[model samples]
Target: MATLLHIDSSALPQGSASRDVTAVFRKTWEEQHPEGTVVYRDLAANPLPHISATALSVGSVDPAEFTAEQRAAHDLRVELAEELERADAVLIGTPMYNFTIPSSLKAWLDQVIIMGRTAGEKPSAAGTPVTVVASRGGSYAPGTPRESFEFVTTYLEKVLTGMLGLEVDFIVPELTLAATVPAMAELVGKSEASRAKADEEAVTKAKALVARLAG
Candidate 1:
């Protein structure tokens, strides 16, 4: 059976656009692969510790020489790496926070991105498909005033594909706050359309990726 790692980093548990779209992706995947297994991680709720100097040095130092904290950190890193390695696909839900991904998600990335394991030349998780549902409070597409400020999708694509060697797909729901914000009233319709398109794409991509992996 196929295994999927599902991660959610949105602090807002309820009514989160990223979560909503990712739910669609996950549901579709489960339907297609009824015997598949899913591993879920809610980064916001159960946040990972940021990488410390000890964590960076854990690999170089002998296991017997490691401090208690370093040993624990190393263990967590290994667990996260194993989770990714076992999974055929990873689905991540993240909302843009301060023009980028949440700190919780960043910490999780730091933990899994090891020197010669998940990162470096010929990383272990190479070719693994990683689907990201990126929800943004404002529109940051090309030509938009905040386009340059958009770092969520770009940064993830770089780190997941370039660093960890995973194939990346992004499903973005832009202007998520337009419907609730008075100044963004005019963009509400656009936001809804964007979400609708994302919902459809999520299902299609989920099924396609799982089928390709199965074959």
Candidate 2:
């Protein structure tokens, strides 16, 4: 059976749009592939440290000459890379923070996107595929007025496609601010309703995809 790696990076566990939607996706996926194993990593609650300069330094020093800290960092990076390499599929749940992916998620990326593992050795080799399920409060898809504010999805797509050679797929639920306040309250209501509906549809679609892939 295939193993699925589910990484959730939203700080808000209960009310996070990204987490909530990802939960739905995972539920549908589990139903379709009940025998598959899942490894969950919550980056927001248990954040990984940023990569250090020592980890990047290359030298001719013998293995016994390496400092303890350097060895520890290298081991952590190797562990993260191994988890990603072993998974048949990876699902990342991210919410746009300051118009881009959160720092926690970026740190995780630094650990897993290792050279000679995920990518970077060959100039033209096809890389592993990853799907990101992202949630945002505003509309950022193409043709929307806020489309210009779509750096989050575009940046991820570019990095995954160009650097890692991953076939990237995105599920974005937008217009989240359409309901609660005095300004655009009605719009917010409509958008929230739309997003709720989309959440269900996305879950169904994700399940079907998983079934097809696993079978």
Candidate 3:
């Protein structure tokens, strides 16, 4: 059975487009792989601390020389890396904040990006499939005025694919705030269309992943 590492970093508990889309994907994954296991992490609920100088040196420094705080930080990083390393696939629900991913999600990514474990030579998570549900409050697609401000998916693609060598797929729902923001009322139809497409892609891709990995 396949194991999935599911992570959500939306600070908003409700009305989060990324969370909603990822839930659809997760449900489809469960239906297709009933015996599969999912290791869930809510980064909003339990945010990881930013990597400190000591934490950054954990891989190179001898464990025997670690201070109490450093050891604790190192342990958390190890756990995060192991979770990713063991998963057959990864799912991340990230909402754009200030034109990029929420800091909560970035913290989680920092934790799992172990030097020797996920990067460097002989990387353990090199070939894992990572599905990212990236939701934006406003339109940032090509041709949109805010397209240049879109750093969420672009940054993630660079890190997850270029750095760690993961196969990353994106399901983007744009103009998420249009549903409730009066100023964006004119874009509501387009927003709904984007969400619908994201939903459909989530289900289709989830099923395809299951078939490819679990079959």
Indicate the TM-score of model 2: 0.89
Tell me which of candidates 1 and 3 scores higher on lDDT: 1
lDDT tens per residue, model 3, 60-141: 8788988898899889988988898899999999999998988888887787787667887767889999999999989888
**lDDT on C-alpha atoms for all candidate structures:** 0.94, 0.76, 0.91
Cα-based RMSD of the predictions, in order?
A: 0.8, 2.4, 1.1
User: Which structure is stronger by TM-score: 1 or 3?
Assistant: 1
lDDT of 3 at 168: 96
Q: What would you estimate as the lDDT of candidate 2?
A: 0.76
Residue-by-residue lDDT tens digits, candidate 2, 1-215:
87778899988878777888778878887888899888999999899998678665522346677788777777787788778777777788998887889899999887666666566855232454466878787777779887887778888888777776766777787766556546766677667776777687668766766876767
Of candidate 1, the 10-residue stretch with the lowest lDDT total is: 61-70
By summed lDDT, which 10 consecutive residues of candidate 3 come out lowest?
114-123
Question: Candidate 1 lDDT, tens digit per residue, 70-173?
Answer: 89989999999999999999999999999999999999999999979889998999999999999999999999898999999999999999899999999999
Candidate 3 residues lying further than 4 Å off, grouped into runs, are none
Name the candidate that leads on TM-score.
1
lDDT of 2 at 115: 68
